[model samples]
Target chain A: MSERSPQRISRSALPYPYRADGLVFDVQAVLLDGEERVDVNVSRANRRWAFPTDDWERCRIVGTVELPSSVVDAVYPESERDSPPGSLYVTIRCRETIYRDRWMVQSETVEPKTYEVELELQRDGFRGEVELKPYLTRGAADQSTDDGSYASSTHARLASARPWTMLVDGEADADGETGLDVRVESFSTSPRLPKDGLYYLDMGDPSDPLIVVNGEHNRVVGVLQSEGSVGAEARMRDVVFDQIQYGVWSQLILHAGVAVDSTGRPQYDWQSTVLRIFARDLYGIDDIHAASRRLKRDLKDPTTVPEVMQRIDRVLQRYLRQREQLINLMEEGLRI
Target chain B: MSSGDVDTDDGRLADNTGTPLRTLTSEGRRLVDPAFLRGERTYADEVGQYVDEHTSDVHVELQGLRADLQAVVDSYDQYDSTIDAAAAPAVHRRLDISRRIAADPGVWHYLAVVEFPEFVRYRWEFNTETAMREKFLGAGTDIYSNALHRLWWIAELTHDGDDYSLTEEVLQKQTLANKIFDRWFARYRPAAVACCAKLVDESTEVAEEVTLRLNRVFSTRQLEGMDEAELGRLIQDLVTDIQNQGTTD
Candidate 1:
């Protein structure tokens, strides 16, 4: 047979570079002492993440998690088993070459650590549990070990210190899929603890640093950084901002371990509770204050309670009317 | 054609050539033609007029209602305006009904719909199609639609699939929608809905503080590293906590 040109083969099959699975962690923290604590709970049964590839570089992997009906009932007692909590699944596929060159670097080059955690209600009767584990990356298998590079320094610190773990039992299944079962704890040092409270978890590198923290209340459940070089202070600030306005700050306030006083009274300070709840419920405290100020200003006078109430009603009525008029105009304009 | 000249007595406009140029009224204007000068009246204009006319009436009614509310507030011995505001609507409605039980409170409910003043109207430009679309989708339209959407969205955004007690709290708050809902939703999206519900569940003081801080942070932080999904989750978490705290007592 005449020599024939070989057909060009495709280098990659997937659209995205990596895949990630997020698990819902039902984390409970119990403060054993001032400096030590224990956390325990079930991890998010379902995982969700995205992978990258060509054309549409990001691909999503999604799958349903079938927890034992009993577990479902325990976690969501009022929820019917017929309809389990639906989990979002995402996967990203990318070219093998892109995966080799880029995804590898993004996943690896960070250290792992463990932490001790605890929780106590300022009062009695409201108590909770805390759990700690190491957060690890599975995709990093082979890479040059150069400590001079920032990534390398952060990685080295992480590998050597093996600090506190933020993620627990994150691994891939037989099908080359990553699975994580983490207890969604109510507390994280990064978000709740003050900046000074963050110890090692806030050190080294400008992009990816090796920072670790041992909770003073729950020393065992420390938070560790496995990726990014930015200092823990700046990063913690960002995390704090994110958590308070748009992240887990709200969740913690709503579901935090509660306690009661010896006199059968709730021990949580009302003001603190209010602050926590506001941080959790409102995106930021500033917005609420602005609204309150606006409301107060609109009220004009506050001589008596009845007058104040009438003013409030008037304000609400006015507000609703303004909105209605706007909507009506929009509808009319659309028709035109 | 000649008969047209005689038809002039029949009240029709005719040209010098004796043929009708076009129909005209005694006022020398087109009788049947469309007038391009007719101006459009907006809801804002209507509402502004309504407010001006009823200002005194509203003030009087408010005065009476305030007296009744003061009595309730005295009984509770609570002085916070936020708390008093929450109790105002139900209290006002009750007092109004007590005056006229023979007539159901349903008719009075429509009074809540008011006109938009001109100054406020100028604050927003309704010139674009996108803006128009958003206006319709927002909770400011018809009472039934707005109320229904507000209630349902609050429930959807705030509820953790099962817990809706906070949603109830949100519905109870007068400022929840006006002072907090729109701005939060406009700036934050679906997350704001949940946040508003949480704010209601949480102590109003806390909610107020958080909203204030959030606004400040949003203005200062560039937030380049964070993605929208992450932000949504964060907001949801905050709202969830608020709900949890609301039930703690």
Candidate 2:
């Protein structure tokens, strides 16, 4: 690879769409005020960073994100109705990396019903795990919304009770494998996906084996729990079942937990929903109408490893033909 | 054929007649002032030694095709005077020279920029803004824009398997040549062949419309895995639509 730095062109200067071939990110900000979980769905999904040069190494990310209305309602003060509150502040952190400046919430709207509380950020960095945590300074408690309503002293949550969880939907790795891996689906994070690391898959079945990842030791140790005879084909089939469970169920859960970050649905909905349906059909899972809902309630309550894995098998059997066709397309799309 | 037997006399590269020639290094290619490329520095040794290292086997091949190239050059002034008449021989010479030698861009760059600096100067030799400099040096430049590279690529793209008749026909129409470089699909062998075979007898206007439509269609469609039959079907549909539109208008 050439040592040349990856060239970052503005969205306007792009020869092709940044979204079609650029890195896509969907950020979901979950505001937790004690047990009350207020989900703020924010999307900047349309922005794409295209590295046209061969041997691209890095690119600069420059974009703005608007905090959802739910976030504003969560932080608004009820005590003072006459005087508008000061600028609300929030800190967005991703894994170990944190932006130093607290993003101020501009309560005023340039247009009616469109309150602009946008965070303008510019960084030369790769997309990684991101977490947004909103903070209420002493001045922020007095801040007012555009309609000039003060927060009720009793109900206004001054600070984020817990870390805002960003749910990351999975992406197909066209450069390597086509579909998601079992470990990747389990550890899905928001903003950007982390490099594949260690994980544990506990099917919860007493007889089936457990897949465990020792992160510190950097190794995956599988323990066989079943004493019964297991054929080679049966074991291979088990592995495929685990992969489907991870790819379909885990991604479905993540999608349920978070909202898409783009202004509207992406043009390539076919790649996401249609293809995912096809994949699910391979395992005989046929809840197409339920899965289409933007937010799935089942994602909030955690399901056991055994149950999800079993669900994948059931779904794979439902739409065998479509699943095979999708797999063929994905295989053809694979370069290496 | 061996470069070992070739002379290192005064660090100069040589032609087939044992005349000392010039070659340029990769580094010299970047640092050589645009003014120098524009003929400000007329020193004989400017071409450098890279040419000698790479062109050992190509010496005889280049010699055989030299007369055909010179014929095209001789008729350069007659293009505007004769219109479509001058382009056929020129296209024929290009196909002949391009087929005779290896069509590596690096080799063509060396031949057009360094080996034949005098020829480059003679053609766009006096044009300002270092116009000839862009022709020799710009990376990812269309083969149509570069002096030697354009001729070779046109021949390579339009040739029908082993035959050069398709190449001659395509290049015979000046409008097609001008618009040909922009057709990204033409870079594909099957797509190029489909285009040549389909438009072999069409008028320049029809060819222009077809080329324009193909470019627009290719921009949005993921036509990578498409076979020649599929591409032929698509091209025929497009050509039919264009002819229908022309008649309707």
Candidate 3:
């Protein structure tokens, strides 16, 4: 069997030539749709961010990256600049494995001090993360023919910014399966925690948020795995578990804050542990760094209370109207 | 040029999200079903459901390639290897989409599993369940599988701008393409052209040996920095060596 040799990808691992000197190539994805810019609170700390496929539909990713002189030299030696052997270009590349799409969104053939990146990715057909890379392609004179050699050998990525990955999935409704899956499995079959545990995160692939429903918990599994049959018990069980799930939001907020970039985009780096953990308050909270800072409290100080936990309590109170549901249950009992 | 049905069972689709060029994502249901792979049926409406999603809307139009492929499948009564080679240029001609979109597996996945599955079944004949799945959904980045995708890509790699002479030669005659797919170096268009030019007339057995010899040569010498003439000379040297050695062997 022939090994898969994708012509698009360079075969060799490109080591940064100036790693010792700490020369960095950075590409920041500044969403360009809102008046000044988009204020979507996404975690980009891990150099990765996820948007509901539609959230990015109209948004253009704009960022600037400087091309160090040394890197330019790698593409063109001093002696050859007067009459260059090949045309050099800088381009923004978006790569998605799930759908297997890799193509240059933007390209600039003229060598400049910096390369500006811009493009809006289509939300259609693609359901996974798309890696954005800015690399230099030198179409050398020798291989510059009508033949497809340039597509194969023209790219010699001299030096570019660390790649930025754009994650596209709206894991909104747990029942709705698109970007991720919520599986029901028998955890009781294992030698672990309480045999009745309802749900646990299988963090094996941090890139994906897979919520494993413990099949041992009949009530939890039955409710979660059901299509449209929700009884009073299922509704009440959903309300109770909604608290556990809602309480998870505050932590995601904090993590999003700690891992954000200078532009305030959260750099969760691989810690998007629970993607479905969102709430009414989660949306429209533009400045996560500021919000997280206000909600933060030094745990080392014995006198200080983790203010985030308190905030979470308020969030939990409004979760599926827990207080309202509890009161209704109590009143029904008294009437009975 | 016609639009695909946009009404979706899932909310994944939107008003103005992407191009008409579709892809069958690995998410949710698969286009190829189990029974279909087992060759138990010719077609299955329950084969699969694809979400109505797309790359961003762009002004990309295709040249009725699917209809062309369907015609090819119609010509063949049963499994014949020549069908792919025969249909390749038609795929290459009509769907000369942006190399970027072409690189995407989803578009090909959509075609093979959704649009032209009959063609896929006719081409490979679902020899085995494992092989059938690969023909439908397997071969990540490998150009050897996915019946329709393999054909289109093979044509793309071998075709020049507005010229598919090389592409036709590779697919139609079964001359030099498959044997060269093994070497990573042949992905370079110049090298592929040079190698094909040198080995097209050789018999299958002789061509196979020469290709192996060429693969060894590429191991040391870089195809990236080298030009077409140099590649041609290098391949010519190997062919000459083979011709000279014919007397002894």
Candidate 4:
């Protein structure tokens, strides 16, 4: 097959000129290779805030697609291009630590694939996915009478829902169905831990959809939702383990940002471990910030997971000296 | 029509609160606190000018807009109907304001908690405290719940480019509008247009069924990849099935 259309590369770290705030990430791209290139500018129009709340930032993709060289040659053949020949189509994939969400502009038919395109995608800390795809119009050419005006682009969206199989690990509600199984109880909890059943371990928030199944020897095997905050997921892992009470080992799955493993488990990596460490301190403390108010007020509760993560990290910090090894272990197994 | 030159003393302005309200708030903490509204600071005549200048093309004053909104609230004792009518004008007026002003919760905080406290009081008489403190401050997508923000968003999602006839269609049925407002899929313009057309032609019961079925289809499939015509055809089939089911019922 023709070079499988260059699978879009996922950057471990955000490309340069991109910034990630608490819940927002911002990116920008300009024309890279086209006779007449379209300017792709992506940015969040709203302000950024923390997670668990509906503090979603509505980002936008805006740019112009000029008439392509082939089309210009075919139409005017020998005149200075005055008006935009067509509009740009944009698609953005916002990868988060808990889940990978995608937002794509309804694609437009673009003719000859010879145009160069560039874009900068920005989101808040909540959404880390940022890559822009732009192409010239293969669809009907612009009917604008004006010689050189630009066309309007579409809005950016945070993926509201994805294929459930894409996020959770379980037998499909159907024989082989996927997407959000809003009603599946495959991952759930009970008072008496069943010796041989799958259950969603009890995180502080029972409503969280992350799946935890009963593993061998009183342990629970579960994958964290890769789309959630690294800090939040780590905290959930810690809390779920503690709530299940002692003697039950917590085999937590980690992730590198939002990328997961083949079985839909969160991939463990050094970045996620470090992020979890930060979350433990910031959230583990007693009311340092307004966002941490609930953690402080409810610290005394049995379900209220406190910060023992840092203590554990310090111990591991001695042996797992290099971040690369820790990162690899996060993806592979680090049978300690 | 610069926002810095509105006439606060205009007879039409409502001075419901005896104390003056602050026009601009730069600090985050003070922005969320209700105490900021009760400070020594007073709203300058110029501060009031911002709304006038922003909404000049709309030609409606805050006092008039508030009264018109209150009238809708009064007539349609049903919450949904009242919201549909009341929110449309708010969205129309907001379209006239700068996005910079509308995007900031601080500006809206000043409008709901400070400048228009009486209107806020009128709208949510039973829970004014919660309404002013928590609801007024835009929090997440829930910020759309704010009195001003809610209307603007409802309009944003329902409107087709500059044509808001679709908004009017959605306003007639609470089920259709609520689904459109809350769900991201419904914000897809083609989908919204298709849903509104179906809802407008059907009964409330049929509309509900169509919306539910449509949502189920949307959540699973990638509606983003479908073009306008493709979305229209898909929604039309769903509407037809619901209609056939309704007839059998």
Question: In candidate 1, residue A272 scores what lDDT?
Answer: 31
Candidate 1 stretches with Cα past 4 Å from truth are A1-336, B1-145, B183-198, B201-206, B218-249
Best by DockQ: 3
- Give lDDT tens digits, candidate 2, residues A216-292: 32212222222323444334334444444455445443432232221112112222453355333433445443343
lDDT score of residue B182 within candidate 1: 39
Model 1 is docked with a DockQ of 0.01
Candidate 1 per-residue lDDT over residues B109-197, each given as its tens digit: 11222211121122223454323222222222111122222333334334444454544466556565444553432223234544654
**Considering DockQ, which of the candidate structures 3 and 4 is the better prediction for this target?**
3
Clashes of 1: 102
lDDT of 2 by residue, B82-190 (tens): 2223333443343343221332334555555664455455455446544555556532224444455555566655655556677666666656666655565665556
DockQ of each: 0.01, 0.01, 0.04, 0.02
- Residue A128, candidate 2: Cα error in Å is 28
Which ten contiguous residues of candidate 2 chain B have the minimum total lDDT? B78-87
**Total backbone collisions for each predicted model:** 102, 31, 22, 54
- The global Cα lDDT (0 to 1) of model 4 is 0.38
What TM-score should be assigned to candidate 3? 0.48
Q: Model 2, B3: alpha-carbon shift in Å? A: 13
Give per-residue CA lDDT, model 3, range B146-240, as digits (tens): 67667766776677787877776766555456787645556566777777777777777777888788665544333344456877877787777
What is the per-residue lDDT of model 1 for residues A1-336, given as tens digits with 9 covering 90 to 100? 211211111113211111111121222332232322232222232212111111221111111221233332322213223442222111111110001000111232212112222222221111111111111122221234322221111111111111122211122132411121122232353453345542332111111112233345342333222243344433433333232222222222222212211111121222133233232223223543343333333334445434434543343344234454444434443332
Docking quality class, candidate 4? incorrect
Q: Give the per-residue Cα lDDT of candidate 1 at A304.
A: 44
For each candidate, what is the lDDT? 0.28, 0.41, 0.51, 0.38
